[model samples]
Target: MSTIGSEGWTLVHQARQKHYDDRYYGHWLGTRDDGQWIIGRLYPGKSMDDGFRDGEWAYSKRFAGDPSTDNADAALTAYVEMAHNTFVWDRVFDQTVGEAIDLYWAGPEVPDAPKLAAGWAGAESPNPDRVVSSAGCSIAMPLHEAKFLLLHYLRRTELAAKAHLTKGVTVDRHGAVEKVRCATGPIRFEYGYNTYWLT
Candidate 1:
């Protein structure tokens, strides 16, 4: 483990030998000059089995084709930032939850009636007064009330995940909440009440 910056948190690093080859290769977590923590790798010699193997292990020319200034640091920074900002974090949270809600509420028949009914029941009481004042008349209901309710529930879940991811916090192997100290501060995860946080 190595400390990246002022946050006093240590980054995780690991090394392993490729199954077919005895050469040792490893990756380490570090921070960019722009204040982003990223995982960097040191590859061994060239091999056809590895995804990055082109031909030889000449250091000067190895990264020449890289788009991010042909710099390992830059590539790692880009990857970590992309994962944090676009793929693994809140944007993904919103997309996944939104899709789930839309799928569930797309059809006329409610997919999860028991769960939906439970939520609706919790929102209101039995014999509650309707909005309409006319005798024996009911208020016109929105066409997608159930869908809206589902969206609300999904949004709440996504928010929880976002909060956790951003706070530099994580759950431990034993199911305990632990503070994740990073150079950028505490990382919060958006894991919800019922979901697994560590994975």
Candidate 2:
């Protein structure tokens, strides 16, 4: 693995192939200058090492007009600033992060209740660092941010476990509690709990 920075954004590029059953899967994960966690989705024919070499591959379609109208699940869809107790989309798509995520979840495709329930749990949770209560009710940000992070954590952890079972080699395979912070404050993600905290 290698670290690269530019214009305040720090990217950690995985410098090796990430594969399963001899099939290569490629994706990117990094933090923007503002301390928000960002991730790129996997694409066929590209290994994680290839993504490192390509560099900023997700922005390729940035100038293709409007992201909102594009339904394609491109490499980099949207990002959130969990640190600030707020979320920000790349504006690369016309849909909000919540909408995009739901669209993918509520589908004609086979339903995975186990996965769906996890997302729902994230939606119902409050900001761990700050929970404002009013009239026996609590207010919180949209479900997308928490859902996104939790899902990613769950997925990566599963992958790591699978690799371990197979006795395969991998890098950055473990998942655990991670925190991201900025001027706004800090957000803590506890993968073990399958939840997150926003301040």
Candidate 3:
């Protein structure tokens, strides 16, 4: 089920802030439909010695839409994998920090099966669910900031996708965002079930 409740999202933010300077990676707690919490993180901008970095868009998609909550995470994860492999990650290396940031936030290639990647087909289009999500992301940041950023993004994306969401929908915090192809792979992230709220 979608994370319509607002509780537990802020803890995700706090964790990200805690690791802002000294650490390049961090984790947060999110929930499933049953109210089980999952471990998630923000987009780790740099590739740490521990291999902590992944594309920002990928992190957001996974953190918010993980399927294990109901075994329905495939559609979102598959699309994210394709988008990252298709339009996100870059091959250029040895660039300065600024240059790297530019690359991460750069516009993606027209995703394969563009209609498939889109959240919904637009009213003007032949298919109301076929329209690609025009909104993309900005420069990469730490996990703390990344999760919060995604909350705003989720607000935007949900609004853009449904044009009716006012504020309850959330991008979720922690959990293993399993790639659709990795049916047998181990869990990507693991954490305790803790929820944080604004109040």
Candidate 4:
């Protein structure tokens, strides 16, 4: 029995704007094929009037039969998880401290794969209450803040790898970006643009 529609999808869940600071991002759960479900996230539109939008499948899974609510819920969680792990520069302004953070995980040294701790790089220690056993986080912040946050962690000798910052960026917010700044060294930014015109 094919649950998916002719368009190739069946909507199961939709994100509640109340849960996301009233920002209308589309985090939807559905099935593109029978027995296979996915979480699709529509990137926020431009000024709410952008004729077209873009999106991606953040997570997907196949089931023995049709997936249960529990499975759908897990996929929704993955939707949020993917959002927390992706730092879309322009979208950072809508994220809060809780949503924007970095997590440090134990490397191969610990066979059990324990998540050592979670916190942003700006602090001297990981947040005491936010300890996670198997999770990770990602977000964007100013270059100086990133430096202060990662410098100590990078110098740690116990970890199997060195920590480094990605994307040298500094943002200003006064209703909108008032200024644009970059780190002192060589800098690069990856940009992709998508737009559609209404007929």
**Count: clashes, candidate 3:** 14
TM-score of each: 0.23, 0.24, 0.21, 0.26
Query: For model 2, what is the alpha-carbon lDDT of residue 1?
Result: 26
Model 1, span 1-199: residue lDDT tens: 2453343423332222343455544333332333333343435534323412332221211122322222433433343443342213334533443343233322344333322110211111123663322111112223234334333433344333333432334332112121111101212232222222111
Of candidates 4 and 3, the better by lDDT: 4
Tell me how far candidate 2 lies from the true structure as C-alpha RMSD in angstroms: 18.8
Q: Per-residue lDDT tens digits of candidate 3, residues 1-199?
A: 1232234221211122223354444333333433233334344444333322322122432333333433222323343333333233234211221222222222223323111111112232235766543534444343323333333333233334442231233223222111211112111211111111110
Model 4, 71-188: lDDT tens digits are: 4335545655655533222343222211221111110122332222212222212347653242122243434343223322222211222111211222111100011111222222
lDDT of 4 at 148: 27
The candidate, 3 or 4, that scores higher on TM-score is 4
**Per-residue lDDT over 3-103 for candidate 2, one digit per residue giving the tens place of the 0 to 100 score:** 44343333432212434455444434344323244444333344334443344443311212223222222322333322111112235322344343333
Superposed on all Cα atoms, the candidates' RMSDs to the truth, in angstroms, are 18.5, 18.8, 18.0, 19.9
Which candidate leads in lDDT?
2
The order of the candidates by lDDT, greatest first, is: 2, 4, 1, 3
What lDDT would each prediction earn against the true structure? 0.31, 0.32, 0.29, 0.31
In candidate 1, clashing pairs total 17
Cα displacement (Å) at residue 97, model 4: 23
- Candidate 1, 186: how far from true, in Å? 15
Tell me how far the alpha carbon of residue 16 in candidate 2 is from the true structure, in angstroms, after superposition.
8.3
